[model samples]
Target: MTSIWDPIRIGRMALAHRFAMAPMTRSRAQADGAPGPLAAEYYAQRAGFGLIITEGVQPSDDGQGYLNTPGIYTEAHVAGWRRVTDAVHARGGHLFMQLMHAGRMAHPDNTPHHRQPVAPSAIAPGQTMFTAAGLQEIPEPRALSTDEVEATVRDFVHAARQAIAAGADGVEIHAANGYLIQQFFASNANRRTDRYGGPIENRMRFAIEVARAVSEAIGPERTGLRISPGSTLGGIDEGPEGPALYRRLVPALAELDLAYLHVAQGGNEALLGEIRRLWPNALLVARGGRPLERAAADVEAGLADVAPVARWALANPDFVERYRRGAPLNEADPATFYGGGAHGYTDYPTFGRALVAA
Candidate 1:
């Protein structure tokens, strides 16, 4: 049986266990899009995980969606993240920074410059996003020109290099959750007739180019990509061709021999099985809303190389220790899941501390 505590290796990075902390958007950055002061302590607290994937970090100023989300495109951002990586490394933890480009999902009110968000087409997602004034409807985004699209790919490459400079072990491209990359994939969001929007191959061009550029800038062994096929989040409509699209996308990514492929499972066992078969190496599955036991079963059954957990990792800093000891876990409070101070972010008590108090 493959225990969750068993050591594993993904590409060039060696992990102490078969479990990882999934990338989650916490909206805890500073006003300037730099990581908050408590970011180091917050991540260091959860160093017990085999790998710690940081929250969604924008690749450029215009990529920001929610208020106070971090960015890796600036010097200050790199400095702030250096502290986080240093803290995690001191405790023998590996870290991967997730690079996200929000595209049409962004609200101008949430950005410091208040610039209009850009996407593959000039369509709005018909969804609401949290801003300084609270939840507001997303506005129609500006469609990127071919030149601009190329620039955005460069931006991802630059951000990947910055992540490595900031002491991160690798970078996970956030092509999931209806972000910029997914926007190009979904037919409802992308109406362009150009090479970027017509066919499934055209729609996948941006994501593939971005991945290739990032991998070239910072070795393929240090690059990871996260995707959620057929996800309806953020008003995405990939149409019925979603599975076929991923069938083409996954293998192209696999050929790059990237660090790992992180798939956010959406209850499609057949699709997941196909992806697993296509890419037999370094697969990390994120089964949200499922029990840790299921994740464990996945590893034991050789269905997944590792399982990424979000809520449990958030509430239990020493999650692996607690699971090993069979101790009860602290429930994550939804109210404090996003922007907030250390209360719910870093105050979750470890089992040893709880026992000490008892």
Candidate 2:
């Protein structure tokens, strides 16, 4: 049995330990959708994690859903992320940029162009998002045509290339979390009659296409993807055939031989075991809302190759060191979790380093 402290080789990259920092949305980017001023510092502080999967980065203008989130298409974006990558590398840490398209979960007020959001269908997410003014209801999005869908795949490839150019170790396509790709999987969120909707095979097409294109642009060893089975975020439901969909989808993805498969556990243990059996490469499991001990159990039991830590990593920059030392952890402040400067972002003290709490 492999322990969390043991070293592992994931694809082309060899890591010192089996723990990684999960991708998180901090909402601290610049007005132009570039990384925030303190972005490099924030990431480099968590360098001991060995592998650091960054926050979601938009691939195009249409992909932006939240305020001040980073993008990879623009020149400024590449330069901004370059600093982050350089800082992380200096500390002997590897970073993988996660490409995420928000789809219909976006509001006009939060975007740079203020244009209507785009998705597989025209349905709204029935959710309210915090904007510059205040909380506002998300409006219905326009449906994408078949031609537009193909262009979206190209956007992901472009983003992956840009990430490599910026000195990142790799890129992770965000196919989960009720985003654009997952929107096509949800029957309620997607009502199209095209090849992207209706059947399970059709729904999984967009994700497969994006993954294939990205892997071709960058080596398959540098590309990875994240998926959530049976997730209901962004007002989505995969219906009764949800399990069947993944039973087929996971193997189809495995055929691509991606660097790794990240599964965000969504209350499905048996299905998770099935996914472990299907994926031949590295498997990263994020057990959100559960104890860290449980996540470690997955790695020890050979169900997961890596344990991606979230809230605990967010609250403790030297999380690995503290855990090994059996020291106390600082509690994370919920109020400052999103859209903040240095308080909850980079002010987290390491073990025995006295600092004011948020």
Candidate 3:
């Protein structure tokens, strides 16, 4: 039986342990969508994890939706991230850039250009996103013409190339959590009659194209994708057809021979196991709602190769080591989750140091 602290082979990269740091968005970047000094130290401190998937980074200015979030399409952004990647590599960790495009989930006040969010269709998420001022209703997004959708795919490719240039081990396409790709996945948000909407195959078109383009831009060995099947966040609902969509998507993704498939499972063990069966040979990292013990069990049962934790990782930088020794975990401050200073970011002490103090 393998333990959570044991070494694991995840695609082309070898992780020292099976514990990965799940990507948690901290609106700590500059207003211009560039990563700041604090962002570098925050990621560096948590480099003990087998892998670090970064916060949703915009592929272009139009892709940005939240205030003070980072981007990857600019020279300055690449330079800024280079510092972060260098720090993580110096500490013996692998980092993957997560490219996200917030589609109908955008609020005008949250973006730099204040551009209307774009999606596969003209539908809106009917939810509000945080802005500099306060919570504002998400405006109806412009439908991406087929040409524009192709352009968006190219943009992701370019961002993936840029991330590799910035010293990242790989890139993970953020196709989850009601972003651009998920917008297409959800029938409620994508009512288009085009080839990019309607049936499951058409609805999965954008995501598949984006994944193929990114895999081609960089080697497939350096590409990964995150998906949340049947998640209804941001008022997205695909109804009964949701499961069928992923049943097709996972096998198709597996055929691409990409690095890994990080599935954010929200209490659907049967579906998760089904996906595991479909994605036969790839490194499947299962996340979402699994306790640490269950996560370890999932790996031992061959349900997944790694288990990612979000909140616990935020509070405990030395998560792998702490879990290995069964040390008490630091409680995460929910109030400080989004936009805050070093208080809840990099201020958590390791168990060894905490024990010494006691």
Off by over 4 Å in 1: none
**TM-score of each candidate?**
0.98, 0.98, 0.96
| Residue 183's lDDT in candidate 2 | 94
User: Model 2: per-residue lDDT, tens digit, 88-139?
Assistant: 9999999999999999989888888899999999899999988898899999
Decreasing TM-score order of the candidates: 1, 2, 3
What is candidate 1's lDDT per residue for 105-189, written digit by digit as tens? 9999988789999999999999998887888999999999999999999999999999999999999999998999999999999
Worst 10 residues of 1 by lDDT: 291-300
Candidates 1 and 2 compared by lDDT, better number: 2
Q: Candidate 1: lDDT of 33?
A: 84
Per-residue error for 248 in candidate 2, Å, reads 1.2
Please give the lDDT score at residue 159 for candidate 1: 94
lDDT for 285 in candidate 2 is 95
Runs in model 3 lying further than 4 Å from the true structure: none
Candidate 3 lDDT over residue span 1-358, tens digit each: 7666678776678887777888889888876667877877888888988699999899998898788889999888899899999999999889999998988878878888878888878877788778878888889999999889889999999899999998989999999888889989888888888899888999998889989989988988899999988778878786888889999999888878888888887666788889988886545565656676675777777778887878888998987788878888998888888886888787888888778888
Number of backbone-clashing residue pairs for each candidate, in the order shown: 0, 0, 0
Each candidate's lDDT (Cα)?
A: 0.91, 0.92, 0.85
TM-score of model number 2: 0.98
